[model samples]
Target chain A: MRWKCTVAYDGTQFEGWQSQPGGNTIQDFIEARLAVMFERRVVIHGSGRTDSGVHAREQVFHFDADWSHGPDKLIRALRTGYPDSIQVYKAEEVDEDFHARFSVVKKRYTYQFFEGFADPFETRYFWSTGNRRMDVERMNTAGKLLSGKNDFSAFTANPGEERDDDPVKDLSLLRAERIGPRVILAAEADGFLYRMVRSLAGCLFDVGIGKLEPEDVLRIRDSRERKNLVLTAPAEGLFLDRVWY
Target chain B: MRWKCTVAYDGTQFEGWQSQPGGNTIQDFIEARLAVMFERRVVIHGSGRTDSGVHAREQVFHFDADWSHGPDKLIRALRTGYPDSIQVYKAEEVDEDFHARFSVVKKRYTYQFFEGFADPFETRYFWSTGNRRMDVERMNTAGKLLSGKNDFSAFTANPGEERDDDPVKDLSLLRAERIGPRVILAAEADGFLYRMVRSLAGCLFDVGIGKLEPEDVLRIRDSRERKNLVLTAPAEGLFLDRVWY
Candidate 1:
């Protein structure tokens, strides 16, 4: 049976989502636990890979298991086997053809930043603006320019991943919202290139802090060059918030 | 000059707010940083002490320093001097008679519990309810029963501190509010006895889970015995939220 599950994880201690040799990755932990549960090797496919120090609220994945007790037992087994930093909250039997990665309709990500100085209590979750005030309106304006179908080559970073992935993707939402002292940049796209969300957020932060003009986002997008980007933000502030089918 | 500062910290990494020999305490870090700035030893008096694994949103402290750069500069210097988990946000010169400890009129504490299973991203900040559903109304009713002036011997725990402190105290607010999957218990009092907030929260959680009736809190209070209480919630869920002069 193919089971689709929504998992959440704090990626700070893991070497990202993909397993690589001896590195402590989320995939390695999950697969190892599943192996123990089934008494054999089982491959669990995730919707996408998140970089190190990045978090996930509802990362979807699929794994085939022949447990007689079904999805409910599988969820309980997984939850008991996994550590506190990783959990499978929801699981259900899916159509045999359903694929966690290829079946993805859209993915939503959020990057959080705290304006002014960093709060000691919130440092782990939010990227600090370094005591600088952010212009949310300017950030929103810059974010709008990057929405819809566009070649986001400027926002892509080759983090040992092949650069042959398509640069043109549909972004339904790229906007900024401020909640008290924290600024949230929410991005929903058909798919994101390697480090693309961080790159876009970093550029919008530049606009928010007056380092770049709102119109500069368009120029950078048209340039199709990653070297022209100002920043890639940081992985600690990014979250794979949701995956929509 | 006596400077009053409001500090915040993530207590997960420290041995609480009070200094112990060879222990990593918030006071030790702050004093060490201040000594570096002043080229001499500096002692800071915090309003009160928090237990290990407990957080602080705005712990107030006072220290004597005759630096020429003033409070604004002191805040900036302290910000740079402290690690990400500890910070002094606001500092101001205070009258000579002012005391961070004795002058405190009230203190507010918050204990956070996440209902249902633990979320991986929030494990560090919130206590899990072990996948149990909480009755917020019951918790609130129980919390209210613990309010007002009363002898809270039932909620006090001896933690090496002198139990000579008065057990009679006025609790202004002991309310429970549910936000999404998280239930927050906010308690305001003239002063807290050792582990009083955690004890009250734990007892109320018992009420929430139907193990105890709301009226049991009143019974526990009147009993005036520490053995009458249900439990002492973990320190990780407690926060010294604010101090009111």
Candidate 2:
């Protein structure tokens, strides 16, 4: 049977979501647990990769296992003995055709920013802007200009890296909202390129701080060229909020 | 000149608030920074000591220094090179007679509880009461019975340990408020005994879950004796929210 799982992780102590030789990534931990439970080598696939220090509220994954137990016991067994930093909150048997990676309709990511030095509890999750006040109105304007389907090569990191995914994606939503001292940028896309969300967030922050203009963002997006002008924001501020089926 | 400082810390990585031989305590870190600034060992006093894994939002401390630089520069000096987990946010010169420990009039602590299994982000800070629904009204009723001036020997931990402070304290506030899945228990007192706040929180939680009646709490308090009936809640849920002079 194929099982679908939804997991949340702190990500501060992880190398990233992808499996690596160090055996310290979230995938490594979950796969190790699955190996123990199934008494065989089992591989699980995630929706996508998140950089180190990037959190996730509801990251989806799937693996095939021949277990007769129900989903509740599966969830409990998966949650037991794992580090508190990661939690497998939901589990269910899905159709064999439902792929964790390819079945996605859209994905939502949120980036958090603090206007001043963040408090101790917030340092692990928010990017501190160091007393720079962000203009939400300008950020929204820039976000609107960059919305809809377009070639996002300007926002992709490591252009030389080989990948099969296309650069053009339907960016259904790009908006910024400020609550108290925090500015949260939410982005929804059918697919995202490498570090595209972080790059977009960095550019919007620059626009909000008067370093760049909304028109400049449009020009860069239309050019379909990667340049040094677009910065990739820190991974600590990014969170994978949702992955729609 | 004597300086009063208000600091905040995420205590997951520290031994506690007091100085210890391991040099891993919060005081050790602050004093080490002060030694770097002053070319001599400087002793600092905190309002109280928190256990390992206990957090603080606004813990007050005081020390004597002969620095000529203004408060802003002093704050910058103290903040520089210190770990991001601990922050000395406020510093001001005060009269020599003012003491961080002795001059305190009252202190406020907040203990947080989650009804179900806490998520990854909340595990470090909230106590998880798995599958238990808390009764906030009953908790408040029990809190009222436990409040006011009383000899709270039942709520003190390590009663055999030598200490200078008295066990009798005027508990000004003990209230439980639930916000969604979280229940916050706020307790204010002229002073708290060792683990008194945690003990109080535990007993109130028992009342909240209908395991103990409010009258039972009164009986425990009026006995003026220590027993195993009161449990000391975990340190991570307790936060030193404020210290009033």
Candidate 3:
């Protein structure tokens, strides 16, 4: 039987979502727990990778197991002795053909920004923009210009790194909304390149703070090339909100 | 000159609010910073001490320092090299007669509870009551019974510990409000005994979940003695919200 689980993690103390030599990543912890439960090696696959300090609200993963117990017991077993920062909230059995990584339909990411100095509680999840005032309308205007299917090479980090994934993606939504002292940027796409959301967020933030014009963003996107002009927002401000399957 | 400062701390990584031999308390950090700024050691007096894992939103402190720089510059200097979990946000010069511990007129504390299982983001700030259904009206009824001036020995912890402070206090307000899946209990008083807020929270939580009746709480309060029946909620769920002078 195959089990699919929806999980959330604080991500502040993690070394990203992927496995590494140090064994400090979220995947490492979950896999170790699975190993202890099964008394053998078991591998679980995540929908995608998130950088260190990037939080997840509903990250999906799947693994093959032969347990006959129901989902509730499985959830309870998985949550035992786990750190409070990570939670496996939902679990269910899925068909053998279902894939956690390949079955994705769309993904949504949200970036949080504080208008001024963030309070102690918010500093972990938000990026403080100092005392600068952001123009939400201008940010949205620039975000709209970058929406839809396009070659987002300008927003991709480590352009020199070799990868087979295409640069073009259908960005269905790119919008910014302001609530009190917080500015949230939501982005939905069929697929995102490496650090694509962070790059887009950095560009929109620059536009909102009058560092870049809306037309400048268009020019940068149309160039179809990576440059130093586009900055990648810090990982702490990014959150993987949803992954549709 | 005497300066009053309002600070907030995450409290998850510190020993407590007082100066301890380990030098891991919030006061130790602030005094260390002040020592670095001035040539001599400076002592700061907080409104009160909070236990480990107890958060604060506006914990006030006062200290005497001969500094010519303004409050804004002082704030910036004090914030330098400080961990993100602790923040000193507001600082102002006050009369020498003003004291952080003695001049307080009222203090407000908030205890947070989650109806079901709390998510990763909320685990640090809220106590999960499992799947139990809480009766907010019953909790409030019990809370009101415990309010006003009374000798609240039943809600005090460490009864055998030596102390000169009186157990009688004027509890101006005690209310419980439910917001969606979260229940917040706010308490305002002229002063609180050691672990009094947590004890009150635990009793009210028991009443909310039908483990105790409203009249049971009244009996406990009127007992004027500490007992094993009144549980003290964990420190993480309690927040020192405000201190009024």
Q: Model 3: how far is A242 from its true place, Å?
A: 0.8
Name model 1 segments beyond 4 Å from true: A161-163, B134-141, B161-163
The DockQ value obtained for model 3 is 0.87
Q: List the residue pairs that clash in candidate 2.
A: none
Give the per-residue lDDT of model 3 (tens digit) for A32-59: 9999999998899999888889999999
User: What would the DockQ be for model 2?
Assistant: 0.86
Model 2, span B142-227: residue lDDT tens: 99988999998889878455887798999999999999999999999999999899999999999989899987999999888778
TM-score of 2: 0.97
lDDT by residue for model 1 (B19-117), tens: 989759999999989889889999999999898889999999999889788778888899876678998888998999999998999999999998876
Residue A240, model 2: Cα distance from true site in angstroms: 0.2
Consecutive 10-residue window with the lowest summed lDDT within model 1 chain B:
B116-125
Report chain B TM per candidate. 0.96, 0.98, 0.98
Model 3's CAPRI class is high
lDDT of 1: 0.88
- Candidate 2 differs from the real structure by a C-alpha RMSD in angstroms, to one decimal, of 1.6
Compute the interface RMSD for each candidate structure.
1.7, 0.7, 0.7
Clashes of 1: 0
How far out, in Å, is residue B200 in model 2?
Answer: 0.8
What are the TM-scores, per candidate, against the unseen true structure? 0.91, 0.97, 0.97
DockQ per candidate:
0.66, 0.86, 0.87
What's the lDDT for residue B81 in model 1?
65
